[model samples]
Target: MPTGLALRDPRQQLFDAAERVLVRDGPTGLTSRAVTTEAGVAKGVLHRYFADFDAFLTGLVLDRIARVKAQATALGETAGTGTVADNLTSALMTSFDPVMVSIVALIIARDELRTRLRTAGTARFPLVGEGSAMIAGYLTAERELGRIAPDADIDTVAPTLIGAAHLLFTERKDSPPEPEAVRKVVTTVLAGAMR
Candidate 1:
């Protein structure tokens, strides 16, 4: 059966296949062959798009980072539209999703991949930092609308929320945190900060 991936942009198809391999088989299971097989493309297809496996891995990480950043950037558009906690939970969900967690774990565990990423000038994935800044910006906007306490330390609150979400997602390996739990985390964090 044709996977139809061959019809998509080769790079994106390879990226999607890499993600599926990473999620289902973990980092050790990810290989050029694996991605090509999953993508249902010729084994040589990935090599044609990327220099090597490391390059592909770095590209995948960077692409995911870009997506996270975009999500964070769009979060500001939700300002004042819903309960602060609800809005925040929705935004943070992307960071803690199963795919993201697997990617983070893979990047951290592989020295070669990490070195390649760092050499590419992305030593650290900036998703958390960027997300914190975006959240802080959103909080500031909310404060202007009187939704948050005027004296709330948005800088601190933003990183705190990110950290809490990271912990919740990373620690609960067997059973992912539920949406309500995510909401609760956001609510508890904002209780003193929101008006």
Candidate 2:
């Protein structure tokens, strides 16, 4: 164990290291050993903090969910402030950034991890589900502000927009799409809803 690790937040260190492993090696490559090694902490450190590898993964996924929720809150507050497409474009980039997109891939690849997340009552599909909800909330607020069609079905629009954004982002996992590319998808998906 590094003497310095005791002074820092081990859980956060592990989570960040796990994130790097997932992005670098993909989900199949995410092992307890990999995380500990990447973190430069002793293997025992992970076990000491978490019950098992599943527990550690659960903690990491939950931490990511919380981050998405924070982004959602920030986006929700922006209702009516900017063009709807512009707000959604920015939110999509933050919501589906590289790490987040990798986390989504991880959730899809690991049945055990997905089961653990569901058992813990994290969002149904984690990032994707939460991302949809985030867009839904923002679209709802815009509807109330009369920036969108009064009859716009925000529920449908939200998921459609998120799904489209997710596709665009995942298409090139090495780099995020240009903001203009995201904005194009946002505008296309929300065309029916926007005023």
Candidate 3:
């Protein structure tokens, strides 16, 4: 960008650019220079907004966590209204979508970023942990409504679903797994839980 040029929302611009770099290059290709270049801003701009690259990454993952929390609220609203399998499938598809899957990979690859995230007060593995919470919350609501067995261990089931969805998305690479594939995993995982 031109020197002294103004951006309406530099943070969001940088974030969106970071996501694009992550998608195209995977974790190895992500760097402060890459993000700034992708954002069309000076490298100094990133430092201005964040303490370091890890801080910037923390911002990105935390932003995503907020999105997952919002998704959780929306998923909670659907608890008793849809088939449990269908609701879970929908949640998995959106919760672990392409960008999110990549973000998870990015998080796993950066030790410093992980430490920084913890320092920033997000000790959980951001995307995966938050996504699991979303699933668990929905399942808990379902159980309360008698849609699922009262004995269902949602804490275990939630992370299992997130892991399976992450695997499907990661292995598929070129495309997202079909809804049927996700549905099958959901139904299978929850078979003992669904009443």
Candidate 4:
């Protein structure tokens, strides 16, 4: 008799496999059978956990959003304890993965993932609002410390700054910007907006 593969819980195995496949191959590669094979489970395991390919895709997108939110959460919790520039820099830097950013930008450029995100409504996703708020929180701390002007509207400035950073860094595949240069953009816009 042939030896069998070691068994693990189906749902855990599916999610773990899906995560690996997504990280390595991204959205288009997340097929049910592929995930099951990666986990050494039967093909039917994916269907048992997720209703369909669409359902699995949705879960994967949401999981990615949750991970970004967790990073933003950690940044938010630490925002007040550091220098304003340092805190904001840390928060923005966490979201800028050159490889994944390029992949997502290409996917959106082809109108593949963008259509889904539009239909899903970007605001409903945790990462957007959570990231914006985290930035705003840091700006507010800056204002309190008089590092920014007294009349800064953190609510508007924060989202605008985050949007600008995302636009510049997340959608391009040219030579990447330097860390110090990126930090300058953050500090300059933040100061200008506050001033």
Against the true structure, what is each candidate's TM-score?
0.84, 0.95, 0.96, 0.67
Best by TM-score: 3
Backbone clash pairs in model 3 (N, Cα, C under 3 Å; residues 3+ apart or in different chains), count: 0
Per-residue lDDT tens digits for candidate 3, residues 1-195, read: 565989899999999999999999999998999999999999999999999888899999999888999999999999889698998899888887778988999999999888877777773886788888899999999999999899999989999988888888899888898999999999999988988
Clashing pairs in 2: none
Off by over 4 Å in 1: 1-6, 115-123, 173-175
Steric clash pairs (candidate 3) = none
Better of 1 and 3 by TM-score: 3
Please, what are the lDDT tens digits per residue for candidate 2 over residues 40-134? 99999999899999889889989988988999899989998978989999998878877888888888988898999989887788778888888
On the 0 to 100 scale, the lDDT of residue 16 in model 3 is: 94
Q: Is 3 or 4 the stronger prediction by TM-score?
A: 3
Query: 30-89, model 4: which lDDT tens digit per residue?
Result: 567778778777776678777876666555555656666677667656644766667677
Which model scores highest in lDDT?
3
Q: Output the lDDT of residue 141, model 2.
A: 87
Q: Scored by CA lDDT, what does every candidate get?
A: 0.82, 0.88, 0.89, 0.64
Backbone clash total for model 4 is 0
lDDT of model 1, residue 177: 89
Q: Tell me the spans in candidate 2 whose CA falls farther than 4 Å from its real position.
A: 1-5
